[model samples]
Target: DAGITQSPRHKVTETGTPVTLRCHQTENHRYMYWYRQDPGHGLRLIHYSYGVKDTDKGEVSDGYSVSRSKTEDFLLTLESATSSQTSVYFCAISESSRSGNTGELFFGEGSRLTVL
Candidate 1:
């Protein structure tokens, strides 16, 4: 398992507030990803970074932003959190294989957020 940690395992905040979630890894994997798990969405990608300062948006990235300043850290920020953003956010790390990305990911426990 990769050494992944997510801060503020649980949180509750009002709508329109800004929230940031931090993901830290000790494995130094080449790739990191943020995903939100909802009842019907399974795991939907919010953003991902392939290397330091290299990031791209994903399927559900409208209200989210991400930053990767170091190999071991990735940050996700919701500019103005909304009720629809209430979900379990997961951080996953993976290393690329010789041919390509292994597509295997080790996930953190998860951060649960609620917007009232």
Candidate 2:
């Protein structure tokens, strides 16, 4: 949703390999976030950026890196893939309201990554 598009919707990789999932948005929202969804963990934040090149680490940021060079692109990179990192990753875009982070996010379908 929100004019977001995730690339490599499904991927299977070996442990220790490197992988990158891309999220592109057409809405030009002011904020973008990376979240992972697991069976028991639900949705957890991985990283988020409020503006281009301005990013902050999230709760589950370890072993992952994100880059936002433009308002329309957000890239999530896994330096070394691991089995524990297997999950559905989502990209969300939102605009800050007068009250700040309205907590209303529009998410992309999701990118499923599995590490063997």
Which predicted model would earn the best lDDT?
A: 1
Candidate 1, residue 87: the lDDT equals 99
Q: How much lDDT does each candidate structure score?
A: 0.96, 0.95
List, residue by residue over 1-116, the lDDT tens digit for candidate 1.
66999988999999999999999999989999999999978999999999999999999999999999999999999999999999999999999879999789999999999999
Prediction RMSDs, each to the true structure: 0.8, 1.0
Task: Give each model's clash number.
Answer: 0, 0
